[model samples]
Target chain A: MKVNEVPQDGNNFKGSDKVKKLVYAVDKDGKYTGVNTKGWEAESFATQQAWAAVEEDLKETEQQVKEGVLSPIAYFMQKCLMDLPLLAKHVGKWQWQVKRHMKPLVFNGLPAKTLQKYADAFEVSVEELKSFGK
Target chain B: MNSTNYQHCQHAHCESGVTSNLLKYAGMDISEPLAFGIGAGIFFGHLPFVKVSGTPGTTFRTWPGTIFKQVTKTLGVKVHTQSFKSVDKAMQALDDVLATGKPVGMLSSVYYLPYLPDAFRFHFNSHNLIAYGKQNGEYLISDPVMEEVSTIKPEDLIKARFAKGFPEPKGFMYYVNEVPPTVDFEYAIKKGIKKTCFMILSPPIPWFGNNAIFLLAKKVKDYPKKLTPRKAALYLGNIIRMQEEIGTGGAGFRFLYAAFLQEAADILQKQELREFAEELTQIGDNWRNFAYSAARLMKDRKSDLVSFDELSDMLYNIGTEEKQFFERLKQVKW
Candidate 1:
């Protein structure tokens, strides 16, 4: 999702159900509380909008990063994590999550620990990963 | 036109109907030399004929006569020129004439430094705008160096140029049957063509974007007969060499230099001269980097497809903006 459109608070899910999928958290009102795209479908209204917004942001961010507005590592971090609010819960666990989850997505045919190691780069915890589904 | 004679003579503005906006903001180091060359090129290349009429001290009508002469010769059209004894008279005279749909062209010596009133320097630049024809009774002129083709009241044109410095016009103009083509420079650069020749040759001379286009169009006169990488490399190399002789700088120089090297590198890359291409690539990258930085400062990056809002922000953060245009397109890491 676009950085501006993203919810600043941890919970405020006023967006549609499609948006709800992109958000792992929600208030009692069914608004998009936060970004946590654990199961974002391309076809859903919220997911489509979120994807569109994210794509646009990514394009801009990529240009900014390419021009050195952000460092390479920071760009990669924001690219992989910022849109997924679920990743924010793991804050300190970022390295751990990168070791466990992102490595597999980034590299092909890697060993099991590679994912864990990538997660370890961000220090993400297994509990945070489990919470992503909730 | 001897370089030294024309160089010292303040006739740089006199020679070319078009002035290099690039000259006014040139920096200390290389920009000065480049500006001189560009000025030389603009003046000598554009203005070829000068006529000091009305018996020198009596009612001298010193204007860019050949520009009109050539137009009239080619198209058989007449242009208007008026000389006023005073700034007010000049302004009134131009206003009355343009009120009938004729805009006046001015020479820097007569209208600006010698005659124009102190309160009217701004209007001097407006008078420099080459008069095209009238649209809806408003005098139309092609102001390629600043604003594109626009129609302004004769009074406003006189007022702006006069405010800028010159109050009276040095040249006379009338409606020519043929309107000059708005030449495209970017397309020529993209297609790997030498542009300086076209700038020197084209009538009323192409300025900036339009000048750039005509040069390219002339280069590729035969459609579907594309400039091959090898040929383009040679052509570009020649351009850089000419630019060196002309003392051109800024985006114009850097772009030519970068394009030359890039074309050479592409040729080598195609020919499996990887190491050579890599070296050329380094040279090209440096030139491109510097050109882009200079262009950003000049607010001349419209060719990069960047939006105005982006340009404003980019101008604020120039260093950061440089890479945004040149960043290697990364493979979409899905």
Candidate 2:
């Protein structure tokens, strides 16, 4: 496989903040040197596409929360890329309790102590957890 | 104590780059690939049981800190490493080490780091950087993945260090306490090669070694039937991101490993290793092709853009090639 060389023209990178990546470049003597990314077309495009997908997911979750179709806990869990089991482990709560809290009705009825636990797990305040995306 | 003498150079991977940089600062010159290979950094594991961002965990390298630990140990370098439960203690301990004029290596989350582009800032918790000193209220960082040295606010650094998630860093940091006058490169090189070959070829579980490639391929092939279309696309996207985005030096560290083999061949004056290096480079290209096809499938979600079976077949080919490569690598009498 031919090593993809960084393009000579710097315009290949899209973002204003110059993002540099390490690429293996061979010198005239055939010795490999780690060089900074001016830009590689394929890698740059792939990274952009991946982040666009993530942004889309974030927007979709926010829309769901605004419509009250999903609880704030579910929104955050998806946003953080966390599953119930992992979130439960972080908060020291049972998985069943976490599942119950994902219901809007149940989450609204929860007292401050339980809400605070969920908040800590998500690294947000109880107020933020309750009123997320409002 | 200051970081005036600390030199930073870009490298294909972070941990190996940090290891190389740290060793160089301590008056030893070791290339990143040498550090990576001698540290036995190359690996493959596709663990469905382990989850990252709702997708099965796929790691192309060994667990964080393994390379640094292994390289320093093999070279007979004494080091101090610690993980703290409290943020206050972790910061104080880091300061204490820096006051003695030694640079500190730390594990941090990319999400909380301000220097990185927003596109790259996911909730990844195992990113490594060097905290060489404190300037005013900020810590001077030598993040190998970045082109230039950067700084981090004290509070943000703390948050990144104590990030909440699986593989939590917990303010983990390390520094060299002592170094020998010279290291036996030949011995370390042979040992590194042997260990890497064993790791790639010997895992018993289907989720590890060369088996992992096939395992992931099968999982990817079934994504369309097992998951909703949106979910399947997201799953496929994350795999591509892991492979291409998070600084595996392109082709999931295969290119970096090939570079290391070339260096090793020259250092050991072994003609056979040079030939093996070329073979691995070809394998790295195959992995690149796999990433390209996978990325195309992800970018265009239309059903006919690229079939899952075609992508899976590409991965299967990579697996077959790598299995044979490692088998031959294991038999080399260095």
Candidate 3:
């Protein structure tokens, strides 16, 4: 790639702030040098698409929670990419107990100590975890 | 070592760029590609069993620290590396190292770094950068993946260094302790190429080297039937992001390797290696084409998206092409 050809359209970068990548460029002497290339249209586009897919899943999870079909734990576990075993490890709980806590009735009956454990594992406050995305 | 003597040059990959820049600062003239090639940085692996962020992990380069370790060892340089359990201790150690006029190389998480754009922030823990100096409460950072030098608050720097996740950095840091007066570039170049070829061609498991490419292709083909539409799209999107978005320089580090071969050709005066470099450049372009197609499919959700079969076929073709290239590369006499 040539220095003159570096992408300058920073608008394609998602979020309010602009992102730049260090790109390799060839000069008149065929020598390679690093140049700051701004705006990754393809990367931003793919990421947006991926995040949209994630949002769709989140919406479905919210609906399920609202309907009492599942508990907030299920939504958070999915969002954090933590399986039962992983979340269990973080919270120092058995996998079976973690799975049981996914039920709305069971989770609601849990003590504040258990709720604190789940909240700490997810890096959220107890209140936040109890009413996630509300 | 004068802090002013350290010149930061941007590169496609971070670790290799940091290694190259450190070498240059230590009075050894080395290019990023040369550092990458001699470091044996190019690699591939797709471990479906090892999940990263809910998706199978696909890597285009060797794990972090390999490049710097391998390159310095190959060039007869002495380096000191350490990881700390305590954040305060790590900060003190880093400051002490900088106080000696030597810049410290550090492993950090990208998510906590404030300089990177919000869109690019992820929980990747293996990102490499250099701490050249300190002023007030800030650490002057020479992040190879960025264009300009940036500074990080001490609190943020410590947080990045101690980011909790898989492959936790644990405040890992390294710096060169000794540099030889001269290096045997010819020998290092040949060794690097041979190692890369052998690793890619000869990994025993199906989930590694050239085999992993085919393995991933097969899994992708099954994804449409095995996964929901949304899950399938997310999987495809992650693959593209890993290949094109993060630190690949573009085309999954193929172009960087080609640049290394070009440099090797100049160093050894090998016409065949130059030709091979040009051929590799075309292969890199082919990889870019694949990313473009995959991205297009990902973005076009309304229309009939590109079939998983088509995407799988594209990966298979790339794997085959890469296999042949490395096989020939291994045979070239340096």
Candidate 4:
């Protein structure tokens, strides 16, 4: 059975790129889509390790952001925001449009579930979720 | 006369006073922080918007940094950051920024969570403060909650405003120095036009948050050429201003601001200085009464207030006044 993630649809510009990366990052033979329990169990440790590394690296940046030393929006756009396109095969127009809209507002509108996760993790509103948006 | 020498307002609760006493000397109804912030915003060539929230949200950045950026961009002011980790260092930064003759504003995020009406529960952002320079080292701040001006050292304000916890930093704030990029109103006008014309116009129903106003102004600029730049800019400012005041639970006051702007525009067109003067006098006198009544309503509904009705009414009025203003402008037999 597939584990439930947060409420997210591939509604952003970089979803395809993100999915591809996720597939590459997780799958050994580049086979994604349907996974068996055995496959899930096999990759669980690897995924956890990868996630830990990413999270650890991000913590330093998060500290800088909180200290007003850097803009997390800028950091996310430069790093993870672009990578989100690897997640899905098709990119929608509205996602790109929203991304463009957010550019002026200091966001690039990547369909990363991280901000929502951050919100959930912090027990704050989704809109109030500070993101390193990977 | 230096930035280090800046002072705060003399009003009660006048914490961050860096504005000139010129208004006070002129017998103006000067409220510290509020007047200072508005004046400083103007002096720095930006419009001020006030936001008061009961809590600070995780997603929301510091109010001063966010607003300083938005207002400066909207008004076509170029701002640069100066580093000052201490009060003395901040004072020197202020002096240096001002010495160059560029207008300056400061952003500070005070962490004081004063009890607010429960209705403001949705807002979890720090009370935002923006102060702009007047003459010499004197600056004014548009403080939303204080509703008054108080003069203090620029360093004190930066500390009081940005320092996170008690026993606040003895250092400086994140200072914002601004000036019209080209010092030419025509350039500013074109910039304003571009901003208004190229952005998405969010429906006025939600009432613009501070940054949203900048985007809305840009969206309006993208309207058809039949709406002249001057008209578009004026309408955009008035629209945002009215919407914002109403959003903050000042329905009656918002109406007056809207109506007075209508009358001001009319008078400007007619070149009827005498009538314009009289209307200005009347507005000045009655605006406070409107504000008082609105404040009382807000106080009563402090815990559960949102003015959807007032917002809709203002949108309706905007449509009417916009058409009238455009028609008058077109038919002016100059």
Root-mean-square deviation per candidate = 29.3, 2.9, 3.2, 22.6
DockQ pick, better of 1 and 2: 2
Q: How many angstroms is residue B312 displaced in model 2 relative to the true structure, after the best TM-score fit?
A: 2.1
- Cα lDDT tens digits, model 3, A44-119, are 6667776666567778988888888788988887665456666776677888998889889898899999999888
Q: Per-residue lDDT tens digits of candidate 4, residues A38-84? A: 11211222222233434555676566556656545423432331222
Q: Lowest-scoring 10 consecutive residues by lDDT in candidate 2 chain B? A: B236-245
C-alpha lDDT of all candidate models, in order? 0.30, 0.80, 0.81, 0.31
Candidate 2 lDDT, tens digit per residue, B1-334? Answer: 5677888777767899899988889888998989999999888899887767666788889888889998998889999899999899999999988888889999999878888876677778899899998888789999998888999999899989998776899999998878898789999899888989888898898988889999988998998789887677667666666665678776678777877888998889998887887787778777767776776776677757678999898888888999999998999886
For residue B326, model 4's alpha carbon misses the true position, in angstroms, by: 10
Question: Better model by lDDT, 2 or 3?
Answer: 3
Predicted candidate 2 versus true structure: per-residue lDDT over A27-100, tens digit per residue: 55555566666554445555566556666877897887788776799888767656677678767888898888
- What are the per-residue Cα lDDT tens digits for candidate 4 across B1-334? 3334333332211121222222222223323322222222110011223211111111111123333443345444444655455566676665555565433444443322222222121212233433435443445553433334334444445434444322223333343333443433223223322332222132243232223323333443343343543333233323322322112211212222222223333423544322332332233223223223323323343323423233233333433433333233323332
lDDT of 1 by residue, B1-334 (tens): 0111111111112222232221111111112112222222221111112111100010001133443343223322234445444566665554555454433454332122222222112112223444434556555544422213445665554433433112233233233223323322223222222222233333354323223323332342321245443333233222222222111221223222322323333433332222322332343334333323322322332334533333233323322222222222111111
lDDT of 4 at B316: 39
lDDT measured at residue B3 in model 3 versus the true structure, 0 to 100: 69
Give a tens-digit lDDT track for model 3, residues B1-334: 2266668777778899899988888889999899999999898899888877667888899878899998999899999999999999999999898988898899998878988876667678899999998977788999988778899999899878987667889999999988999899999999999889988999999987989999988998998799876677777778878887787776778878888988999899998887787677667767666776777776674445666788889899999989999999998865
- Fnat values, one per model, are 0.00, 0.41, 0.42, 0.00
lDDT, residue B316, candidate 2: 88
Q: What residue runs in model 4 are displaced by over 4 Å at the alpha carbon?
A: A1-134, B1-79, B82-104, B110-159, B163-183, B190-194, B197-334
